[model samples]
Target: MPNNNQVLFVKTPSASSIKGNMFLYERKNEKQSWKLADSFPVTVGRSGLAKDAHSVIPLNDNLPVKQEGDGKSPSGIFKLWKVFSYHNLQNLKMPFVQVDTNFYCVDDVNSRYYNQLILADTAIKDFNSFEHMKLSSNGYEYGVWVLYNSNPAIAGNGSCIFLHVWRDENTPTSGCTAMAKENMLKLIHWLDEKKNPVLLQVVEE
Candidate 1:
């Protein structure tokens, strides 16, 4: 049995199913099996589970692929990168960047800033389309950066994948996974930088 000390499973079958069950498993002193630390409801993208891979994603392919502006969550094991919060009210000691006007996630495949989170005024001044991180609501209140394609971004693959706060239980997101505010806070307190934690997203049929 492969042992992943820390893992989060987001399982949902239907693309219309906004509610995916997110289970948090962790290894305590007993390393034989992971214990169910926590479980909660989460919402994925409008489309569904797919891997955001390949620059020019071919249509009618075998494995589901995530493309730019697909509104489908990329389902896979993603290295939990940075945490961003709209405000600094929480005293949680984690790697966090407070969302501001300057912060943006570049999605324009044509620009060199593809799949990168950069300041609006600094990187790629020519790019017109990008996700303004601060403009969102509770979802942007606090979330983790899911490093799906952060390294030397692939042109057509998805960008700005994240785990954020959802509007409500019935609400689905654009492409990122959304959870309740309380659940998100719990995750924030639980996460530690040393572990190199990852978010594992999967779909169940």
Candidate 2:
């Protein structure tokens, strides 16, 4: 399948790549080739890549796959579900959710809220654990939710995959893609709802 018109192509050179950084490229239309969007350096998981989608390459002893807390960035084509920020100052054409401490992405495999974003005060109180999404925090100052397993969560697959701000060029995330704040802002502003923007993350040969 082809990437949607607006594609964020993140390319990693190899599987055992110790350096988690990758190049981010963007393109406006499908008719045109992708262009280097910016110097938006992104940090992936320390363990490298995992097959997260249906089209992902088959796994072997040599290749890693995704499970809960694998610390490997999911490889596949996915959509940008929504923009979430810890700050209310986001200026964009799309609507963004101003997240608070109560906001959580449930990771409990047996809970009813698995792989779903729910409020902490909700009746679903019993869960193994969840990420306390805070935008004001250093790790999540600004972020956009990446639609990974949203349709129907397969327990123990993966959760809380997002595109957010990184501390610096040298930091690596648990299983998310992070970049410079300015570059994140540029991506936020450039993403249009009409174009159906999507993220295509692949491991390079």
Candidate 3:
């Protein structure tokens, strides 16, 4: 029989592999769906969530509008925003991971975005410093947002959201997801205007 090709694939984060980042791959057969592209690893949160769209947040800049209690990386669908690596930042590597710290969550309930954008200034005093630059765990500074209500509302309930390089021995992340250096690069490359690339983070139920 001729080899059959499938459309999509699925990957479930487990207790053993949650710390190890995962890669998406096309299915090899009809019976079997998507498989891990390789044996890479990911850095899961200490809380250990489960496989639910309500717990995955897209790093894009469209949907899942940020909310007051909405934690960063709130579970939901979002798109991959632009690239802001420390290698590309103002040329600095003070920290370790090459992350972006420019993004902010719109925490104002009265505003249109509410908790969405690294939004504009507000009358609130805390809002004033919202524009100030923040550093990533890796010391890099960048920003990313997403569409409204794409993933679940449980993505970043643990607090803080990010997609950066995974630590050696695959340490657990504070609440963000992480991967290897090479994988991080690959993710950046795969992301673009099309395909609407997104990161699906799931915890162990």
Q: Candidate 2's C-alpha lDDT?
A: 0.75
User: Compared with the true structure, what per-residue lDDT tens digits does model 1 show for residues 108-163?
Assistant: 88888887888877674867788888874666888888888777778888888999
What lDDT is reached at residue 179 by model 1? Answer: 91
The alpha-carbon root-mean-square deviation between model 2 and the true structure, to one decimal in Å, is: 2.6
Clashes of 2: 1
Candidate 3 lDDT by residue in tens digits, 2-39 = 23231111133443344443555434454666554444
> After TM-score superposition, what is the CA distance of residue 98 in candidate 3 from its true location, in Å?
12
Off by over 4 Å in 3: 1-18, 26-39, 50-78, 87-103, 106-160, 202-205
What's the best-to-worst order under lDDT? Answer: 1, 2, 3
Better of 2 and 3 by lDDT: 2
Candidate 1 vs candidate 3: the TM-score winner is 1
Alpha carbon lDDT of residue 20, candidate 2? Answer: 44
What is candidate 3's TM-score against the reference?
0.50
Best by TM-score: 1
Candidates in descending TM-score order: 1, 2, 3
RMSD score of candidate 1 (Å)? 3.7
lDDT of 1: 0.77
Each prediction's TM-score versus the true structure: 0.87, 0.86, 0.50
Candidate 3: residue 80 Cα off by (Å):
3.3
